[model samples]
Target: MVQRLGSIGKLLVGVWLAGVTVATFVVIPPYQGLGDAGRIVIVHVPTAWVAVIAFTVSAVYSALFLRRRRPDDDAKATAAAEGGLIFTLLSTLTGMVFSQIAWGVFWNWDPRQVTILILLLIYAALFALRSAIDEPERRRRLAAVYSLFAFVTMPFLMFVAPRMAESTLHPNCAFIKGSDCNGITLQVGNVGLLGDQKVQLLGLERQGDIVVAQVKVSTPGLASEAILRPGYDLTTRSYTDRPTFPGQRFTLALESVNLERGEARINMEAPGSGLLANQRTLWVFLASNIGFTMLFVWMFLVRSQVLSLEVQIAQRKVALA
Candidate 1:
């Protein structure tokens, strides 16, 4: 069974490599400001996800080991935690590289950055505690308990804590945008699908023309205001205002304005369609996620085999005595 599982794992590793290649070379377009460096997203984001998954798996098995007193469950838990740590380290390194490009500094002590560092230390301590114990059963029991205790901090650090902070440039805009912005919803067509009916700024652009500008949408009841940069020019048909630099995140808002009719219509450009966008980002996201998940499973299978072999060797030594 171990050999068969190992063979399957080897095959999947090749698949993972292929997926990564495609994600890097084919999918995912260059982001604004990030340019080609944004390709690191394929590696960093996936590794972080795998790290979280591996830790969760370790915690689950640790709970199972305590409940049933199963040596196999303990083995699985230990192996999973080790794999999780490896991915977490990779995630941290990649994130640091990305930070250097985006924030102009390698280590800025951001909230998310500090939290991940703390997580790494916690798991490192888990391994240290296991190593100090000489007896197999005792070591397994203690490790299982420690794993459960340590896991309490995972969710808080990875998800909740970041949200509570005033602001973060981590590119996690799903929960919140900027410090004051609650959320963002793109205004499309003749009327908004959501929010109150209020046309704050009308007659800014000509009645029938394409406007290339950055639009910032603030949620309902918020003091935040939307900004359209590089004000439109009738003659040049180009943005002459403040142009966006590379790697900056901005949405290209398309709208039709008519002063006499008092009608303004706008819709966000499809992702990866603009000159600054890369279409393959979504594909890269999928490939990275699937590839690393397979890798974690493979690592677990190999580790489990080694652990079982060690157990057999120990039993044989006692029998000889």
Candidate 2:
């Protein structure tokens, strides 16, 4: 019965993974809006997440195997490592596809991609090392030690090594929103696309060169009238803001901002040149922040209700030991 249950568990995991693969290709938003580039996210994110989980699971099993010298631990570790390598390979491949689209080249020496590839190489080495050792007891011991060492080195390679060099691919840990290391440039970049690194511009696409909306926004507290700018010009079909059109998306710059009323007034020289929006940034930001904050609060409150005791017990156990 136990063996049967294990078989069922394996079947379930297989089915779930197959479902994820199907969902990525089969169920997606409008391709023209996001284009073929968006497909990269489905495969890329899941495989990378699974790869990390696999490495973590392998580490746990290795620790258990080392403690108990059990054959089961070795088997589990081998399974995890194998799965981890496969997922890592998938991540690397999908990422390369995205890179080819965003960058002119197939492979750019981006720190994030390089680090992921290096991780793959290290895991591959671990497998080779495991095979080289023939004695059963010695093989398990060596494999556990190697896995532990590789796992430790991963942080250094993925986080430390990448930052130590120049990168164009993923956002640095320093640029991550709400991160402690976020600099002034990161904050500015978050506000303005031009202020961001060149790579940030790669992701945006210009749908049309027409002014979508125009509004005379009047704030109750300060401004009498605020011109809400459009991302593109309507009449000329060219960018209202000159020199912004040679790229994927136009950067909308406006007149002086009114901080007191919390608004910016856009002044367009041409009336026929359309630059308007149906949905304003302020509305988008407000909705996003409210939703995000509520989610955080909900997660915290729920976890506090049920998980607080478990957390407290775990802390106490740590303290006692």
Candidate 3:
């Protein structure tokens, strides 16, 4: 049974490594529509997931080590935490890139984004705290307890943040998109390692219409504005004969915008045919989130063994002395 368990562990690790290769070399870039820049998602998303996983694993190992009085768990926790932090930083940078593309700005004070920055800080502090302690047992206990606090705090950062923001650029979205996971869930079938879901954005274009200019204005200023020609019908996604005046420039309008100082809820509509806007947000959230947690569970299991090995080596060295 022990040998079989070891074999199974080896197989799982091998497959995971292979999956990482596929995720990087094949799946991520094509799926996310990230162009050359999209390659970053593979690094960013996975890093984030790994980071969260690392911290979570560290906390768990800390708990287990406390209960069992084992040294191996302590080492494993440290390794996971270290790995997690590296991935988390990478993920943040990737996100900043996407933000620049989609929102026309590199950094926004969106609650979720800000929270990630905070989480990174906490983990950094954890590392410093661990290094500061000289006594091994004391270090383990302090690190584990801190990990526990951080684990407890992380979900609040992910969830509770958006509610507190008043005027923010971040979209308040959910994970799991409420779609029948029946087809998607089953098709992707326990393929937890494969998270290459695609998000599609659609807009109809006329034969000769030109995109003249894009103006992002304050809400009140949008109330009386007509950016596009009156004849162009935005709702039907159909328009009269395209105007060739502005050379390949498409004129788009935002409805219900403020002419003076109110918020402009730009009339971005959910796709009537395919996935809705809210649905997409939820998908992005989930596709990018769960792995974050699961990664730590991986760390917790792996870390315990490493700590034991260190204890053994230390004992041998002491005996030799």
- Model 1 whole-model lDDT (C-alpha atoms): 0.66
10 residues in a row with least lDDT, candidate 1 = 174-183
Poorly placed runs, candidate 1 (over 4 Å): 1-5, 174-279
The TM-scores of all predictions, comma-separated, are: 0.69, 0.53, 0.57
lDDT of each: 0.66, 0.51, 0.50
lDDT of 1 by residue, 87-113 (tens): 999999998887776545566666788
Model 2 score (lDDT): 0.51
Task: For residues 1-321, write the lDDT of model 2, one tens digit per residue.
Answer: 955855665565556546554544555432332244545555565567667767787788889989998766766776677777877887789878765654434566677788898999999999899889877679879999999988887777756886666433342221121222222121111232221223111112234533322332222122243333344443443334422112112222332322233333332121211111212322332333333233233333333334335435755887999
Per TM-score, the best of the predicted structures is: 1
Between candidates 1 and 2, which one is better according to lDDT?
A: 1
Give one clash count per candidate, in the order shown: 7, 7, 27
lDDT of 3 by residue, 201-295 (tens): 12222233321122222221122322222123334434232221121111122222222332222222111122113343334434444444444
lDDT of 3 at 42: 44
